[model samples]
Target: MKYSLASGLQPPFTQRESFVRSHPDLYWRNKGIAAYEQNRATDAITAFRRAARYADKPSQAMIAQMLWVGDGVPMDRVMGYVWADLAAERGYPAFIATREKFWHELDRDEQRQAVVVGQAVFDEYGDEVAKKREDKALLLARRQITGSRTGHVGALIVSLRLPNGDFETVDGALYYADKYWKPEQYWEWQDSLFEKLPEGKVEVGPLQMPPKR
Candidate 1:
């Protein structure tokens, strides 16, 4: 089916004034969208990617859409999934449902690549969220940063015998405990899984929120 950027599936980023003003490539993208509607697949794919190189959010989502449906280019399942996933992460609700549908359609190999991407983003950012909540800062980081949770299985627990003194694996994915850590101790392992306890106390969630005014 032909997809329209004007449809409800279209996101808001494309409407940003700066997005249109700053991207010279958008001309080609607009042309390509028109061409695709007219059944010009090859031209549309070429134009879409050209636009996407400088695209902020909406354009990226549209490119992913084109790839997802094999509209303008040969269907590359892995790339398509990644692009669509990215779009969804950026608050593109339309991408959420479609990306999920495409995920299930992928072969085993394609699914595995998605898993790797999933693990990397989660492991690196999960602790950050926990830290923010712990600080009890008034401002909340946009959920966009934590959006990656939508993907699949996180990292595994290796052995707690590495040189780092923390049984962590950098090979596949990194999954630290969801809990917090206490101050230093010899054998007192904090909330984390490591060779030794953390050097200082690391709290997750609002460990110290001052009393309300």
Candidate 2:
């Protein structure tokens, strides 16, 4: 099933904005996409890296593509391979294919370099480290919104204004914790937002180089 934070009528506008602010990974991903669409390759790469802190796979793959081709940054096949490998960690078929493509293109020395550099890259942006960052942000956002560190409001009803301007009441504790606070659930939900790839040759490279600034 597709995941979406806003799948249903979400919380109040202010709460939604606060949640977005807390999740810098999502914010940076959106920023990177916007900059990339505007042909600001340097800015897009920068934002993508920021998103990589939380193990945003799409951003990680984008970084790999850009770095491999020397689009915005200097071409570094080793680093590109490193990013692609990280993006493949969740066993996504598209990402795994991309990682393998990068591996096949590397020479012995570059392959060795990728292994060495990959250790450092994983130390910083791999799932183990990055997921912790997301968990912390999730906890903080939950606390801020619920005014409860445990996210337990105990039968309190919270009124949420939908996008259609209709207000609905929901169980405050369950709504905040299950829907937004729990890290694993939240990540799973967010992951659903990614577009489903058709079964075929997944394009592993950038479509076109961004215009040189």
Q: After superposition, how far is residue 80 of candidate 1 from its true place, in Å?
A: 1.6
Lowest lDDT block of 10, candidate 1: 178-187
Summarize candidate 1's per-residue lDDT along 19-97 as a digit string, tens digits.
2332333455676666666777777666765554433234445666666666547776776777666545533344455
RMSD per candidate (Å) reads 22.1, 5.7
In model 2, the Cα lDDT at residue 188 comes to 73
Candidate 2 lDDT, tens digit per residue, 86-146?
9878766566677888899999999998988799899999999998887888787777777
What is the number of residue pairs that collide in model 1?
5
Error of 2 at 161 (Å): 9.5
Models 1 onward score TM values of 0.42, 0.73
lDDT values for all models: 0.44, 0.74
**Ten contiguous residues minimizing lDDT sum, candidate 2:** 1-10
Model 1: runs farther than 4 Å from truth? 1-3, 6-22, 115-213
Best by TM-score: 2
